[model samples]
Target: MKKIAIFAKVHDPRCLGVAEELVTWLEARGLEPVVEAHLARHLKFEPGTEPERIPDSADLVVVLGGDGTLISVARLIGERQVPILGVNLGSLGFLTEITLDEMYPALERCIAGNFQVSERMMLKTEVTREGEVISSHQVLNDVVINKGALARIIDLETSVDDYHLTTFKADGLIISSPTGSTGYSLAAAGPIVHPALDCLVITPICPHTLTNRPVVVDAGARISIILRSMNEDVFLTLDGQVGMELKAGDRIMIRRAEHRTRLVISQSKDYFEVLRTKLKWGER
Candidate 1:
């Protein structure tokens, strides 16, 4: 309530303008508005705070962009329990559900501590090569393992909790948290799991076997995927934002994170409403 952080997608001019307006509004109410160093330069303010420091310094983080931008902030918050308010600059977003018209009202409730906070689960993903951990990332969405454009169908020998599951011969495999059910997992014919459920979904992308279907597993399950395809340009993408090239013998491990992302829900709408608006339910 005292120190507020503002982050916006610089690609959209409207987001930047709204961020500036938010700064002024927050300042007028005797609140300190701290901005990221890169965004501060664009807003004509002196740079003092870094993006990583937002979680530590700010009481609340207001994001002005789509779900992608909010996802980046979620990763930064990483176990910090800070609540994030996402304002959709354009159309209705899955994660960024709050609209421009409802921003101030939402902020008013948030400032007064009268708002509802929804806690969504996160995923801990890592890459291991030759029995050594090479890379690790915390994601609010799914962990994707796919091949490059030039590569053919890759093999992913997957398992759950030390049990051998199956070898999926497909273009990719999506290991998604329940909160990420509406994302790439849905596009790959995965089930739309409710965010409240603590579970994981494994969906194969364009599988060679028609019988290979998406499977929903317990949240405590640890998915171990071993890349068995050689001479293929395989990749491991995290939350559709950051990616890394994978070798043939590399191992991809995914598990439920210990912490969750606390999101400030839209005051006027619910999750079903969001699905209806975004997916156009009951429409011809």
Candidate 2:
């Protein structure tokens, strides 16, 4: 890809220096580097492209930060199908598996058109209030419906393909894609599903019923949940980034989205290798 877009966590002090070097490196190779507006401003560079407009012109996107940063970019580039290279500046990350030391080499491979990409499924979430659609979002990771700290255990009436399931009495509920199995869902005792799998995971956060367990379903299944807890502080979060407060009668619809996020695989390591390293597996 000739047009490379750079997205960085501008809040980090190290990002400025690394972005400067990256820009110079790309220029020396006769490649065009497009910087996100916020990062470009931090670097004190002239006019930069806005985040929304980057997908229209960029052939590839390179995100420099933790998994959170990469996840936000994935949402921003909805339906574009552009490949993303995630470089972690700090500790190991599930999504940003590529380390800072391996960044340049990975870019070289991408520039040479010799790279592999993993197609990760996304989720489409809609909120319906009083028979009218209020808001909709596309998320690469999990969708969380949670109760406020002061609120008592909330009830979530869940279903699959219009079939009534159980009404979950818990602190919250998480609906995640296979790609997001390692995220919040995993923390709530959800399964660690392989990214290649086409499935959805439903995990309850601190359920009232001890037997309540996480459920895995086909990706094609349409899951629905309604908030049954009245006059309580309930919220719906998308990828742990953005969200909205939920009402008593709010209905949530979640399903696999038509678009998927394409992540460039790190040539230096495989998925199991990442898992072992990140989770400290097999370590005494």
Candidate 3:
């Protein structure tokens, strides 16, 4: 039997019902469903091991929730190269594009090893203080650095590949992967890039100068930013999930990670269909 891992947002009341149905379906088909440990209590069935252990044991992963749940689990499955099928239980989602009615068919395809995988690029961000690396995170979305609500405009000395790019005087800056172009980058008026493209975009939030605009750089280039202002409330955030407070003289470097998130796509679906449904493109 192929070991299939399942994860979900346990807080969502809707997941409990669907999870029970899915577990029974998997069992009847001679498939072993390994559910995340923490969600066992919420789900109406006997589950498998811890969520982190899923990456080690399972051949495939199924995520049942919104984009945030998938991202949180994706962090745990880093570098594993396991194909993930994200089912949308929340509102319209870009990552979790598959719907409830289409779940079983997608799983059947995955089990038969006939699904298409999208190798989406990920970002690696490092925080250095006084030449010492303090923290690092691998994220699927953008790395954002911004000031607190009450703080004044800050200065970030930006560079690409050991060369000085510019010193940005703005509320903040965003370093986004192509997969994240539709996220916070889009909100900052940055361009929407296809996930299949191997590149990154840097956008300035409320930049001091009208000419300082969003810039897209090659994926191989290393983008660095040094906090030039002192005694201010600044932060470095990843995937809009976790974040850390920033200090003056802090240096942040962002680049493409060695591994990418392998997303399982239905054979009947295409990227443009998802974009059109989510964005309501060309509709009157």
Predicted structure with the largest lDDT when compared to the true one: 2
Write model 1 residue lDDT over 146-202, tens digit each, in one string.
999999999999999999999999999999998899999998889998899999999
lDDT value, candidate 1, whole model? 0.92
Note the clash tally of each candidate. 0, 0, 0
Tens-place lDDT digits, model 3, residues 144-258: 9999999999999999999999999999999999989988999999999999999989999999988999999999999999999988899998999999999999999999999
Clash pairs, candidate 3, are none
Backbone clash pairs for candidate 1 read none
Q: Alpha carbon lDDT of residue 57, candidate 2?
A: 84
User: What's the CA error at residue 37 for candidate 1, in Å?
Assistant: 1.4
Off by over 4 Å in 2: none
Which pairs clash in the backbone of model 2? none
Q: After superposition, how far is residue 168 of candidate 1 from its true place, in Å?
A: 0.3
Higher-scoring candidate on lDDT, 1 or 3: 1
lDDT of each: 0.92, 0.94, 0.89
Candidate 3: which stretches are off by over 4 Å? none
Better of 2 and 3 by lDDT: 2
Q: After superposition, how far is residue 12 of candidate 1 from its true place, in Å?
A: 0.8
lDDT head-to-head 1 vs 2, winner: 2
